[model samples]
Target: MFTEISADEHDRQLELHGPLTAAVRRLVEAGISTGADSETIRQAQLAVEAIAETLEQQRHDGPRTMRHAVTGRPVVLADPVIGVRNAIAPPLTVQHTESGRCWTEFTLGAPYEGPPGRVHGGICALVLDHILGEVASDGLRQPRFTGTLTLKYLRATPLGRLRAEAWVERIEGIKAFARGQILDDEGVTVEAEGIFIAPAWAREAG
Candidate 1:
């Protein structure tokens, strides 16, 4: 996985010592000197970057976590499940919670850029599966594995920052049904459903 650095860190570094190298300053100055259009473009980009950095810094905790039944909360798992949970844990860049439902909020950066600067649909599915599965089992404790996942892209999810919510709809014997949605500030961009299996090992352990 790539190490995520907050935009605020970039801004803080910029402010604390100014542009570290003359190269950056030179680039900006050159852009400014080129023409009005260039200056306008540069300023616009810089302002956006500055805002992103500031927001990222302010949300240093990463994603926000929510515990709501509608969102499917994660069950507390034991042993190896605990280890995996910890290892694959969402970045401080994203929030996570395991109550009746499970949810986490975080921003994706250039690394996750699929279509230009927007988040890819497949990535959204990946998140939905994990979150929905976790909620299916209630978290580390119950530990449900993904048997099937279906995602519908209602709209393109932007790359910068995003919010996601997931929860279990119901459970039938060994199978758990779950659903989730991803949203930008505007509204929902992706909706998903998942069928998770509670492995025999996990069930036995529990």
Candidate 2:
């Protein structure tokens, strides 16, 4: 089950996190493309070590369940697809509409590039899977695990800002069916469908 936190507290966490995560992401981008001298590389490595040491000194055991530390949301903060603090994430932002649709948008950087400047096909599938699964779970109200996911790539997705939308197609008992699509500036580049099943624990909890 998802933990509960005050909205004000969540906002505070986001405020505190914004600059820190941005700095880390910038460091990651620089590390990926830097053509620094040996001395510069050594200095950077030492700086990273110092940061790691500070983190280790302050570390404490965290929650066992996969939930966002700040928002208490069901989504994992370490997830590569949508984690707010994950440097590897395109860091997709999902917005749930009252009309029962989930919309997401993000820009992919060089780290997510494949086939020249285009986004990787596998990455497209990953993002679709997550969005479809979110729709299946009804915005995490009734948690479900992905059972089957199928995707079709219509065209290569460019490595810049992308958008995706997903919605539940049907639901029967503990099973949910969903459909989604990913789009770039040109148009839809990938389409997907998926079946998700409520895990035994979730069913029992419900």
10 residues in a row with least lDDT, candidate 1: 75-84
Q: Which ten residues in a row have the lowest lDDT in candidate 2?
A: 63-72
Per-residue alpha-carbon lDDT of candidate 2 for residues 69-94, written as tens digits (9 for 90 to 100): 55446745567776655667777778
Candidate 1, residues 1-206: lDDT per residue as tens digits? 12334455434533643322333334444543455676788787898589658756863343222222333432221111121122222231223453587677776654445888687667777677666766776663466788999988988898767777888788898899989988889999999998989888777876
Q: Candidate 2: deviation at residue 105, Å? A: 1.3
lDDT of each: 0.61, 0.81
Largest TM-score belongs to which candidate? 2
Task: Give TM-scores for every candidate, taking all chains together and pairing residue i with residue i.
Answer: 0.55, 0.89
RMSD of each: 12.4, 2.5
